[model samples]
Target: MSVVEVREDGPVSIISINRPDRRNAINQQVALDLQSAFAAFDASGQRVAVLTGAGEDAFSAGADFTDLPELWRCIPTVGITTDKPIIAAVTGWCIGGALVAVMACDLCVASESAKFSYPEARLGFTGGMIAGLAARIPHKVAMEVMLLGATLDARRAYEVGLVNRVVANGRQVEEAVAMARELAESAPLVLGTIKRFVTESIMPKGPSELMGRATRELGAVRESEDGREGMRAAREKRKPVYKGR
Candidate 1:
């Protein structure tokens, strides 16, 4: 089966992350598939796209750590521009780079069991992963998520405006589809125009550029003592020891 599945339901196109065993983690292929799905949705008669994960367990666990540096650098919609409207239907464990995808969506719906976090700080890099957090949610909430690496449940995510709706567990996909259908009922061109107008004016630049700049300026950080130490600790399944490095 394909790692990413795209199906059309009349005017709504549903693009699902189909890696349940890995909690729908984004890898190089997944990233490419997601981009292709979105592009198809944009080019088709479909008026809206609903993004979700397969199974009832997870929306996405984030990027596969094993695919870091190279593959992890290419995230779907992170820095690219699109005129289409995509809605996120989150179920569970929407953490790390997965949250970045969620932030990229125009609207988001989460199941009660859904949880979110940004652990890239622990991995020792900042810009490429979460450049959209502050723009999507409050600065304080963004800071807490990125710095403290704490998990935010569905209710809290909704309260902080990180999610548009919070449904009961297992109902996220249903609710998201309903919302997509509703959005599809509108004039497609007008909706697209509005989406572009608002996003271009308010949304920050593409995350790819920001991350590219970050990777260049922080090249030393990747080779720093703390960077190597953090990787070692993670490999050994222990807390990382950071000694001013």
Candidate 2:
């Protein structure tokens, strides 16, 4: 079965991460499928895209630990500035690299049960969350999130401008689709132009540069002593004894 599912809803395209059994954690295959889904949405006539996870448990739990090193390398974490608008329909635990995916979207509509976090510090990896989330939330909030591995519930996330909407539990996808449909009513060219202008104004580096930076930073993390320890601990179902190396 496909790890990611892409469906058309009139002018809106819905792309869902379909690994509910794994709390939607992204592995290499899932990463490739997700990229393909977004590529199709961008190339198609779909005016808006809504990204979600299959189950109510999680939008994504982060990268699967079985092959932690390959997760970041294969996952599409940086330089995705799509001309067409994309919305995130988040619920449950959206943690670690999952924060990057959510923040990358133009808009996020989360359910009451949704919780956002960056726990990569514990995993011996620096989540590229700062660059992705800082522009969307306050500097202090962003710092705390990455440094302290802080978690924010749906209401708190909305209050801090991390997400656009907080709907009742189980309504995340519905609300996001509704919002996308509303956006679809506007002229496509105008919407694309506005998105491009806003993106250009905010992004500090070009997509290519950002991608290169992400790869280098993550590569360093993968080679760290703590990185191997973290992965081993995860596979062993125990706490990592981080030596801060």
Candidate 3:
């Protein structure tokens, strides 16, 4: 069976880590499949993607210990970038590379039963992407999570802004799909433009440069047919139909 399964759910594509027998751990095949799935989703013109694990017991227990070296190399270098947003639907436990995957996503919706940690230190392994940890959580919290190597519950994750929403166990995927569907129904170009703007705003650039880029992007959007439709739809009190212009 495939280590990862990709399925279409309307405008949202679901990419599931399917190695539940191993707690959905990341291995060589899993990494390749996931990379392929993401690429396919981007090329398929899907509006959004929901990434999850197959079983209720874990989102991913991290890298398969037996293939740690391969995973270490593959995790960082391989993965596709998609213009469409990706939502991580985390359930059960997340650790190591699993946490990395979720952090890479645009949004994260986690189940209340979910737990997170990076125990690499305890195992004499170095952590991946220290800068990412610092960027995602408060300084002290990020330090504590990494240095202490303690698992945190989903509620704590939400409080730290690492997770967007936390729902009851088994509801993470459902909640994420609902959010994705809402996004998919909206103007795709607007969403892509906003994502680009946010990304540019965070880059190391002067205010003038950032503002210039934002102004140009906005001007382009404002001149598009979708922009006119958005206004017309507001006037008509109905949803806008955007053709991705």
Candidate 4:
């Protein structure tokens, strides 16, 4: 069986880590499968996606140690980006590379049972390319998570803005799916445009360049029919039905 399972639920595509026996530890195959699943979701033009682990015990314990060298060799393949919005449903024990995976998503919804850590120090390694965490969390908190190798509970993560929401145990995926469904109901072009704008403007780049890109890209979405539909729906007090146009 595949270590990762991709399932589509209407406009929300779910990518699940299925190796519960290893606490959903990522291996080379899992990385490839995850990349494939995200690519598929992007190609399908899905408005949103949910990434979660198969079992309740762990979202992921990080990369399979046995496959460390292989994983290191395939790091580029493991990091895939998509235009669609992704929501991470963190259940438990999110650590090391698993933490990076969750951070890569647009939003995160975690269970109360969830615990996040960067144990690279303990393992004689360092967290790699964690741009999102630095952007999302306060500097002090980010430093602590990195330096102490201590686990932060879901509530603490939410407080630090690392997690958007925290639900009861076993409810993470359901809540994340609901959130994804809500996002999917919006104008796709507008959503995608706004995501790009914010990501460029606020994260990882200078404001001037991001502003230019935002201004150039915003016009396309603004001129779309879905934009009009959004306005009309607002006036009508009904949900907008966007055809991704």
Candidate 5:
């Protein structure tokens, strides 16, 4: 089975982390799968996406302990560059790297049973992608969650601007999908412009986020058709015209 699952709902695509056995914990393979799933969504006809985990027990227990991923590679805005909006439907525990991913999304919908935490400071290790949370939400609240490892329940998360809406546990995905459907009906160009403006011009990026964006852009160039053409031309000792795709 795929570590991540994708299913389309007209203009909205639901991308799920299919690891209920691991509580949707993100390992290296999960991270890579997520990157591929979202990249495909961005390039497809889907105008919006709702990202969620398989079960209601936990959106994610955070990064897999035994096999920690380069978690940044799955985070929105960082690893993937798309102007299309992503709405996170969170239920249960959204901790560590999970919190980082949700905060980067354009909007978040959390279930009443949901809980958000960032315990990296206490764990004596961090990827530092969560630092951008301070710029997204209130600094004190971000500091409390990151530094003191304070847990924010759904209600508190909504109040602190960590989540856009709070709903019943099982309704998180439904509500998020409804929201995405609404967005899908809007002018795609306008939505894309505003999203790009806010994320690129308004939001501040942390070091890890900056690095992730850099690598994603470079990888795109390396994987482009023009890149392959150039390589093939060099091998044949002939000049090649580039399509600039």
Candidate 6:
């Protein structure tokens, strides 16, 4: 099975990071898989996506230190860009880098047992993307989490606007999927328009977020069929025919 799994239920695409043994921590492979998964979701007929961790001991225990996954690559707006809405189904522990993804999601449903903390400052390093949390929630609260490494339980996260709602332990995903189903039935074009306007116009983008977006765009072009065709044409001394994919 894939490190990250993607399945469809009508217009909703559910993507799960499947490393429960590691508390669903994101490793290098998992990051790449997640990046690819959302890219596919963006190109798919799915109107909404629910991002969750498989087997729910944790949404993720942050990055897997053994491989140090490129944490940015799996973050919602940062690594994966879609005009479609994406909801986070957070379960159990959401630590360190995991907060970045949860914060960036358009809507978040957290399990009551969930606990979110960002200890990167104490851990002596950070991806720095979490800085955007201040823009999403109150500045002081974001600062508290970042500077003091404070933890937020699901209820507190909702009160502070970090999460949209909180539900019982195993019902987080179910709740998120219910939300997704509602979104799925809405007008896709209108939803996409509003989401894009907020993401590109209303929300502020920090340096790391900007860089992540640029990197994601670049990576897309580099991995596209046209990029390969261009290289082949250059080697063959002929003009490349671009597919504009």
Number of clashes recorded per candidate: 0, 0, 0, 0, 0, 0
- lDDT of each model, Cα atoms only? 0.79, 0.80, 0.78, 0.78, 0.92, 0.91
Better model by lDDT, 1 or 6?
6
Show pairs that collide, candidate 3. none
TM-score (all chains, Cα) for each model: 0.80, 0.80, 0.78, 0.78, 0.93, 0.94
Pairs of residues at least 3 apart in sequence or in different chains that clash in candidate 6? none
Global fold similarity of model 6 (TM-score)? 0.94
lDDT of 5 by residue, 31-53 (tens): 99999998899889889999999
Query: lDDT for model 6, on a 0 to 1 scale?
Result: 0.91
Model 3: weakest 10-residue lDDT segment is 69-78
Model 2 segments more than 4 A misplaced: 69-81, 127-129, 206-209, 212-245
In model 5, the runs with Cα more than 4 Å from the true position are 225-245
Q: For candidate 5, what is the TM-score?
A: 0.93
Q: Candidate 6, residues 80-183: lDDT per residue as tens digits?
A: 88999999999899998788988889999999999999999998998889999999889999999999999999999999999998899899999999999999
Residue range 165-200, candidate 1, lDDT tens digits: 999888988899999999988888898888888766
Off by over 4 Å in 4: 69-78, 205-245
Candidate 5 residue pairs that clash: none
Candidate 1 local distance difference test against the native: 0.79
Candidate 3 stretches greater than 4 Å from native: 69-78, 200-245
Instruction: Give the candidate number with the greatest TM-score.
Output: 6
Error of 6 at 92 (Å): 0.8
